[model samples]
Target: MVLAHAEHSGPRVLNIGEVLAQLSDDFPTMTASKIRFLEEKGLITPNRTPAGYRQYSENDVERLRFVLSLQRDQYLPLKVIKDYLDAIDRGERPENLPPGVKVSPRIVSDEFAAEMTGRVRALTEEQLRTESGASVPLLQSLLSFGLIQHSNGRFDEHALQVAKACVQLESHGLEPRHLRPFQAAAEREFGLVERAVSPLSSRRDAASQARAAEAAREISELCLTLHRALVQDRIARMDS
Candidate 1:
């Protein structure tokens, strides 16, 4: 088991496959690429062996369990979890962290939490259709344009904001039909990630491909998250 690098002398390190096999029963979606992506996101840093192979200790496994559980059960984004872990690493007492954030040196993981912003309210379908000219046909156009997507058969908060923008334009006789340009722009933006992650899809190995595909999804999700924040920030300036 890996302890905090600071807590004990370094011991034997497990390979990537071993790590997955050990945790797959619990985290079915855990993959080597997922592990690497977590590292890229600054969540966990496993030590490397002489040949540059990743060698995770008990601590790494425990941390992985914590992160995977949060993502699977709590629906948190990796960036949120990373921030929480970073705080505890610096000896900070995060208010949301489970009381007594301690792990056995031989055990590899512990649960924790970071401060989070609250949710934004989304406009309802009636608001979309009546105020924004967002009829079902218009909604489909937006989806075709890649400007909108369903969240459990409902439009997301960002879609509502975009729809609101359409409403604002409608006052001047511009309709949702006039927003196809936005959809085209979104397509181009999505294409950026698609091309960047194309190699992952080309790999023939099932496990390797699965992990890479997830990493790509996670990266795109992160981009969407940042994009949402930027859009909201810019909109906030309107009130100022």
Candidate 2:
């Protein structure tokens, strides 16, 4: 299990040799010297035991994996990768990820980390309908109502999610036309989020842009929670 923090009370820490053993399969060329060089370059910082032995947390291992993947796959220079890591450490999502490289969270299972760098498949219209189990008329309704959209004859994961949810709601007598208010409400909520993050977003620096994106994500989640709570509170009144 990956521990978020490197406290001794948490998961067992790996010595340098153990860390190499864990990573060697994917990075056979990796060595103690290379790891040390990375540390000198400010790429990673493993903890030191009482006797001066290097100890690495699971998060450190994942960070190393990310750094190595960027170097090998994207051929990114250490400076660029360091900047990306700095943004991530600050809880901001960097914008310069290569096409298929996804940076999973530090506290991820080994299996999950192994599968982290894959591409998101863009579904065709037929594939979206098949995967979502959305009927032709329902799909048409979703398209007309602006509940879902496609680009270049392709739909992304978000489109599929909206289609599937619309299918489920259709059974409960909620048609696409009846869901227009949701799209409007989403637009209004986005306006609020956009306005709140505008100062950060308007800045030209990569760090500022990343901060703006993170802020928007956080604000959007809060808005969703408030919307859900308000709806639930009204529904509870019917039980009184």
Candidate 3:
């Protein structure tokens, strides 16, 4: 469900002029021709009425805001902006998003977007145990089994998440040792992502670096989706 907010079924009530009226205060130079140009470039697809008039939804207006903000603030080229929008269309958060760029909640889950934009406070060992409801022995077992690690005496959001998952699994009779395969599988998947993005990563340009990061993020999300589907399929087979 985290990635399910990409589609919009809202009514497209704003005409092109209405959309321009809403945005022109912020993007003073925004014009009908510019909006049409973005559509021509495949960056946005506004709905069309039977009379051949363009109809823009609230989501469409927010999307235009995202695109224009990137252009005006970051000076990013349309191509790069298109890549970011494409990733959003696929329900992905683009990596290393420029600070303060607003994304539409309709296009991405707020929680997923916050993970990219917000910083998680590092948890102390006691804090981790309290927050995750993990016992000391279980935390020790997780660290011993290489399922989680603390860095510089601090556990991060990831460690907390893993600890919480392990606690839940423990209740189901699965222990830290039983979850080692997941760590290994994660490493293997990350390796595949690294290799896939190597070409873009090797480039020195800012745009290329951004592309590589986005590609890595997108690939990782896809890998997780595949893994989840496979696991679900296996579990479903138990009933058959």
Candidate 4:
């Protein structure tokens, strides 16, 4: 049984995979990446083996469990959790962390936020059709082709933009049926992004989630830029 803030002087330590296996049964969302994130935030310092592997003591595990509990049960933001951990490290018994506190840490850069911001209001199907000049059949085609998405009973900004783009494409005789390859290519790109951020997304922390999101956006942007450049090169070759 793990005790809260349990201390141990023995040399027993667990590796990242072992730690995840041990904690996953309890904290189903726990991951090796999250453990690393906690270490990065100075919440729990594990020893390093001769081969540069992370070795966590029993106390470190307890501290990690404590911090994760605060996150899952209390919903305390990472900054608050770090402050509490700092207090504990100073040999101070900190008060109970408040529950359900909504704090947005500056986990994302301002430029990234600006680049990624979407329309705040969700549009219904009718509203989307009216705003994007897309007919019902076209909207349905977009939905069937997975070009638009609706989650929790709301169509998001991406769907709106896709509808508008499809409308414009129709004017140029590029039908929705011809756009399947674009969606498939996008999915492939997303697969690459997911693989790239596997280390960070493996963690379940707020900071990791935020960082992973930003990284995904940046990677996607890079992929789009590359695709555009390649298309431009093809156009130049055709002209030549």
Winning model by TM-score: 2
TM-score of each: 0.39, 0.60, 0.59, 0.50
Which tens-of-lDDT digit does each residue in 1-240 have in candidate 4?
A: 111222335656787887787788889888778888888887776777789987776667667777787777656677667765554454333333343332111221233223224224567888998999999999889888888888765786678889999999999999889999999998899999999998988887655654665577678899999999999999999988
Which tens-of-lDDT digit does each residue in 138-180 have in candidate 2?
A: 9898999898988888897779989999889999999999999
Global Cα RMSD, each model = 14.9, 9.2, 6.8, 16.4
Cα error, candidate 3, residue 185 (Å): 0.3
Between candidates 1 and 2, which one is better according to lDDT?
2
* lDDT at 72, model 3: 78
Instruction: Look at candidate 4 and tell me the lDDT of residue 185.
Output: 97
lDDT of 3 by residue, 1-240 (tens): 222123455555788999999998999889999999988998778777789888777777877888888877777788778878776766455655665665666555566566445643568999999999999999999999988888798998779889999999999999998899999998999899999999989987565777777788789999999999999999999999
TM-score for candidate 3, residues paired by index: 0.59
When 1 and 3 are scored with lDDT, the better candidate is 3
How accurate locally is residue 64 in candidate 2, as Cα lDDT from 0 to 100? 88
The Cα local distance difference test for each model comes to: 0.63, 0.78, 0.80, 0.70
The segments of candidate 4 whose C-alpha lies over 4 angstroms from its true place after superposition are: 1-120, 151-153
Residue-by-residue lDDT tens digits, candidate 1, 104-208: 324322321211222323445665676666667666666666666665566555677686676567678776577777677677767877777778667654434
Error of 4 at 159 (Å): 0.7
Model 2, TM vs. native: 0.60
